[model samples]
Target chain A: MPSLKDVKTKIGGVKKTSQITKAMNMVAAAKLRGAQSKMEAFRPYAEQFHAAMASLSAGTGGARFPLMEVREVKKVELVVVTSDRGLCGSFNANILKVANRAVAELEAAGKKVSLVCVGKKARNFFRKSGKMRKDYIDIMGTFQMFNARAIAQDAAANFLSGEADEVRLIYGRFHSVALQRPEQTTILPIKPIEGEAGGAAAPASQAVYIYEPSQEEIMEVLLPMFLNVMVYHSMLEVSASEHAARMTAMDNATRACKDIINNLTLIYNKTRQAGITSELMDIVGGAEALKG
Target chain B: MAALIQLEIVTPKGAVLSEQVEMVTAPGYAGVFGVLANHAPLLSTIKIGNLVYKKDGRDDIVMVSGGFCEVSNNKVTFLVESAERGSDIDVDRALRAKERAEKRLAEAMAQKEKIDRVRAEAALQRALARLKAAGKM
Candidate 1:
């Protein structure tokens, strides 16, 4: 049993902790709004890019694009994105779980797997596993588009160089503060839609466009741009998701701390009352003895 | 028929412009090209240059870094790596950026480093595009 003084000290410490947690919660909440809006603003551009790519791939002429070439998977590169910090509950764990499962599945199928970790949490997790081939630790905190571009360029170069046969991105998809889903998406060899009329079947009603430059040259330039944009959008999504997860986690933590402080305060009060009553009882007994 | 054509300009950050327009002029990789309503389905690579559109008889300009353009179903879309509207371009800042890129390009050339030269050239091109869109070039 703790003494009254000890209990009082514990209560004071808990109160201080609760206050700090509350402050952290408020700060996370403030950051969350900005991150969420940034994510929302970028959604339309990503969606339209995907739509345009889908439509183009559906056309007959898409066969001419080298990126449309589907090859046998031999080696795979996994681009895993996680939070730089670990205070957010389960966000990093969820992404790592998905990535681990993917790696296991790929290895089981007799394929070589490499990891390109984007954040400190991912780097640490994969480094412990002894599986990460490329780790980008410096660029995780800033979450800039140029950083994403550089990473995407590196991955694309590796794929084009035949260092990796396929490239996949594993990330946490942000839906809401209450919902984050881990997803794995294939990034390379751009999958073509099945049963779509080829681009050669241009609508007869539409006028024929004369290409000033060759079509082949246009595709060569566009493919890299598409890859860079996709990577940048993914980074944005992951950043927003991290902020949302942190906000929710900190809020819950602050509430929990408050509850603990309240319970400790109650214990401290009870202990103090017991100490005062025992002292009073001793004084009255001593006075009665003296009267006797 | 001259039906209004849908034009959308998008960058990695987000969609910057999405509206119906009378016409659009883009800096194609080969040269500048103009598009009208009912234009045939086409896909072309774009260069770092000015993009102009006429909407409700008002001319609007945008600076676009190199990317791709696609037209289908009377909708024209520009998937640029980066884009900034002319109205949003700060003249002083753009001038500074241009000078910086020029200096970097000269230094890279002097050092005889192809990679750095190429990067500096791209920066220069982006700055030039902004200036062109702002009507300062």
Candidate 2:
């Protein structure tokens, strides 16, 4: 049996640990709010970009844009986005798992797969593999649109230069605070927005548009902008999802720590009571012997 | 006929403005143009300059960097890299930016650096647009 002093020391250690976890839980909650607001703020920009692209592409009348050309798939670049820091309970691991699975699947199909890791966790995970085309490290905490623009530009360059025939992005999609799932999307070879023809059937959509400079010039700018929007959207999603995952994980840790502290406290109280009872029994026995 | 059009100025950060306005005059790549209610469908790339819209006969100026504007269905949407209202422009910040860009340009000219010269020129243009929008230029 452990001594009462030892039990007390253990209880103190557990209490300190619980306090740290509780503090971490609160920090995560606050950070989650900021990240979620950032995600909400980006939606308007993305929506406006899409609406502009839809109308522009509808007027193009099947002009062959270089970014839209689909070529034979010889090489694939997987852009995996994850959190820069860990302790978020399987958030990074799930993304890496999905990414690895994609790489394996692509390799099995007789295509070369290269990685474009977007966070430190992904960089470290794929560091030893030697298949990295590029690894962007330590940008999650303060990522901006320029960061996404840079990544998209690199991916576009690779595709245009024939280094990679295709590019795909994998990120954790935030559905709610309690749910996030890994999602993959193809960002390259910019597909013509589906339902373009159907939209023209509407009466209001049939109006002729006066294009400035020219349609082709606007399209030339629009396609690249579309790619940038795709990358930026994914980055925003990953940022929000990371925070939610961390909040939930920290909350669970705090609760578990509380339960541990409760159990330890119960044991400490019992041990102290037992010591008091034994001392009382010894005093009573000594008094009875004196009376005899 | 409706006398007002919906004007929305959106950046990657968020929508800066979304309200009904009497008219909008933007700095288009082709040239500066105005849009009223029921204007024809149009799409144009914009430059770094001041944008003005009249609401209740009050002209509200906004500064926008290079982006595009789409006019459709009585709506004018500007998707720019960044934007700021005339009232939101911090004169001190704009002044500092102008000074920094000027210094960079001077240094680039002395060293004959083409890339630095180009970036500095763009920065100078943005700062000038901000000042011009605030009517301090």
Alpha-carbon lDDT, every model: 0.80, 0.88
Per-residue lDDT for A74-120 in model 1, tens only? 99999998878878889989999999999999999999999999889
How would you encode candidate 1's per-residue C-alpha lDDT over B41-101 as one tens digit per residue?
7778888889999988889999998778888789998988788999899888889999999
Q: Which parts of model 1 are misplaced by more than 4 Å? A: A61-68, A104-110, A128-131, A138-143, A193-217, B1-6, B19-22, B55-58, B72-75, B110-112
> What shift in Å separates residue A96 of candidate 2 from its native position after superposition?
1.1
- Pairs that collide, model 2: none
Q: Which lDDT tens digits does candidate 2 get at residues A44-139? A: 888878867776776776698878879999999999999998988888999999999999999999999999999999999999999998989877
Error of 1 at A240 (Å): 2.1
Candidate 1 local lDDT, residue B51: 93
Q: Enumerate the chain B TM-scores of all models.
A: 0.94, 0.95
lDDT of 2 at A81: 96
Chain B TM-score, structure 2 = 0.95
User: How high a TM-score does candidate 2 get?
Assistant: 0.91
